[model samples]
Target: MDEGANIPQYKLFINPFDLKELKRDIWIDDPIPAQLKVDGKRLEIDISYRGSHIRDFSKKSYQISFYKPNMFKGSKQIHLNAEYKDPSIIRNKLSFDFFSELGVLSPQSQHVLLTLNGKFEGVYLEIESVDQHFLKRRNLPTGSIFYAVDGDANFSLMSDLDKEIKKSLELGYERKFGPATEDFFLQEFIIKINTIPVPEFEKEIPKYVDVDKYLRWIAGIIFTANYDGFVHNYALYRNRETKLFEVIPWDYDATWGRDVNGKVMEANYVPIEGFNTLTARLLNVESFRRKYRNLLEDIMKKQFTLEFMIPRAEKLLQLIRPYVLQDPYKKQNIDQFDQELEVISNYIKERRNYLQRKLAKLN
Candidate 1:
C-alpha cells in the first residue's frame, strides 16, 4: 500500500480487538483465520492481494477488489490481497452462485482463513481477479486512489456515452442521486437527477428497467431479492481492446434476508440522512421526480404484493442461513442484517410511489 494518494482519509473504523481475540481462538477450524494486535493498537489491515487491491473505507462491502494493472499499483503494492483472513467472516459459495444467477458480474470468492504476518486474525473471500481491461483505460501511478477517473472518455458526464446509448433508446447509468458522502445542494442535485430528457423516439421512451439487459437485471434483483445493486453499484465498462461496453453488477452484502431479531433492518441500509460533506447533496429530489416519474410510478404500482419481492428474498435468506449463523463474534449479525433488508426492501417497494409522485411535482 505505498501509502495511497488520492485516497480520502476517513475516521477510523471500530477496531476489531474483541473480534480478533475471538477469531484467534476459533480460526483453526474456521474458514478464515485472524490475529489481533494487543490493546487495539494502530495497525492497518492490508485489504489487497494477488492482482487485486481493495478500496477500503467506502460505504460498501468488506471486499478485496480484483483488477488488472490499469487502475492502480501495478505489481508493487501491499494490498489486502494478502491481509488477515478469518474464514469465519467469509460469505458462503451460495452467495456467489445466487449473485451470478441474478445477472450480476462480481468476482467469485471462496471462504478461507487468513494468517496476517505470523498471527491468526481474519478470513478471506478469495475471488477471481478481474481483467484490467474492464476498467477505465488509464495507467495509474503506483499509489493513486481516486474514484471516478475517466482517462479515455471525453470526461464530461454529459458527453461520455457511446453512440449507441446516446440516441436515448437506452439509458446508461444516469446519476439520479449522488452518493451520500457528497455535499448536497440544489444545483448539483438538479444536474444529478434531471440530466435525462425524454427521447424524441416516442416508441421507446427510455423504458424503466425496460432495456433488455436491465429488465433482466431488474428481474434478477427481484428474484434474488437484493436491491443493493444500483446504477452506481453497477457499471458499463467499455473494453478498450474490444471497444464494447458490458454491464457488471457489484456489492452483495445486503443479500439474503434481514435478520430475525430485526436489527439489520434499521442498521444495514441507511437513508440519506447519515451522509457527510460531499454526498448529502447528491439526491436531486426534484429532478429525480421529473425524469423518472413514470418509472417510479411503475415500480410503486408493483413494488408490493409479497409475490413479486418476498419469495426471492426468502430464497436468498434460506440459502445463506448457514453463513448467518457462523460469525464467531457474530460480527455479521443475522437478525440485524435481516431487519435492514426488510425495511429497505419494503421502502423501495412501497414508498417509491409517493417519492416518485414528489419528484414528478418538482420544478
Candidate 2:
C-alpha cells in the first residue's frame, strides 16, 4: 500500500526486549524508552499501551510521553488510539470536535499513520493529553485534573460497582495533575452535590461548577449517545482562578449509534435528562432545566442536523479511506468501514427525531 503523503506518519523505534516486555504486561502504566521519528525529526519518548479492554484487542492503543523540555506539537503527552472497534475510526475525533463546537473544552485530535520498528502498525487517532500542558496551550489558569477511571466516579455517595456506601469520595477517580491536597476539593464538591438540599444546592452549585459549561457537555454527550459518558469517560478540571469544576470529554469512540462493543444502539437509549447525581440535581432546579432545554433545542436547530453532520463525517471518512484500506488490522471490517457514513447519517436522523420528541419533558 502506498503511504499517503497527506497523512502524518509517526515511526516509533523501541528496543525489541522492551517491546516484548510491554506486550507481556499490557496493564502496566510504566512507559518504556523509545524514539519517535516524525517529519524528519527524531525525539526521545516513553511509550506504553493504553486503555482497559482495548488492550486485549489485536490492534492496541498507545500512550506517548515526551521527556521534559521536549514536546510534540506543544503537547507533552498524547494518546494514539487504534480505534479497533470503531469501523469509521473517526467517532472519537468527530465527538471531540463536536464538543468543542458546542462551547465545551475538548481535546484536539487528528489522524496519523503509525509504524512500529519500520513495520506499518495502522492508522491511529492522535489525541491531545488533558494535563497542565493542555491548560497552558489554551491560556487557562493552573488547576487540578482527575480522570474518571471507572463507573464509581459517578457523583454518588454509594458505589456504582456495588450498592454499598463508598469508603472514600475519591473512589473511581485518578488524579492526573495537581497536588494530593486537591483531592479534598473534589471530595467536598461531591459531598455537596449528593448531600445538600435542593434549595441551597441550586444557589450554591454555580459557585463550584461552571453551570453553562456542564450543560453544554451534557448536550454533547446526549447528542453523541455515549452511554458510558454519564458514569465515566471524562476528566474533571478545577480552575484555580475560578474555583469551579469543568468537564473534558474522553474515550468517545463508543458513540453515535454504537455501544462500547461496537454494536448498534437505539437512538433513544440515553434520555434527554442524562444520568449521574450531579446532573439529576442540577436539572431538578427549574432554571437549570430551562437552560438545558433551550440549549438542546438551539443545537438541534443549528448544529446537529443531517446537512451539517453528514458533510463533516463524509470529509473525515474520505481522508482516512486510503490509509484504512492499507491497514492490515482493518481488513476484516473493510465492508463495515465503507458503510459507516450511512450508519452515522441514519443515527443522526433517528437521534434528532428522538431528542425532539423528548425535549418537551425538560419543560
Q: Highest lDDT: give the candidate number.
A: 2
Off by over 4 Å in 1: 1-95, 129-210, 225-228, 239-244, 259-262, 266-363
Candidate 1 lDDT over 1-363, as tens digits, reads: 111122221212323663364335331322222222323333333231121122222111232321222123232112132212211132223344544654544445444333334433223333443334223223411111112212111112333334232322122333222233322222232233334433422222222112333333333343223434433334443333332233444434343333212123322243212221111222233333233344334544554335555565556445434443543333355565455345546644443333434443434
For candidate 2, list the clashing residue pairs, or say none. none
Cα lDDT of all candidates, in order?
0.33, 0.92
Q: After superposition, how far is residue 91 of candidate 2 from its true place, in Å?
A: 0.2
Q: lDDT of candidate 2?
A: 0.92
| Residue lDDT tens for model 2, 1-363 | 566678899999999999998988778999999999889889899999999999999999999999743787898899999999998999999999999999999999999999999888889999999999999999999999999999999989999999889999999999999999999999999998988886798788898899999999999999999998988999999999999999999999999898889899899998989999999999999999999999999999888999888899999999988888889899668899999999999999999999889988988
Structural similarity to truth (TM-score) of each candidate: 0.37, 0.98
Error of 1 at 40 (Å): 32
lDDT of 1: 0.33
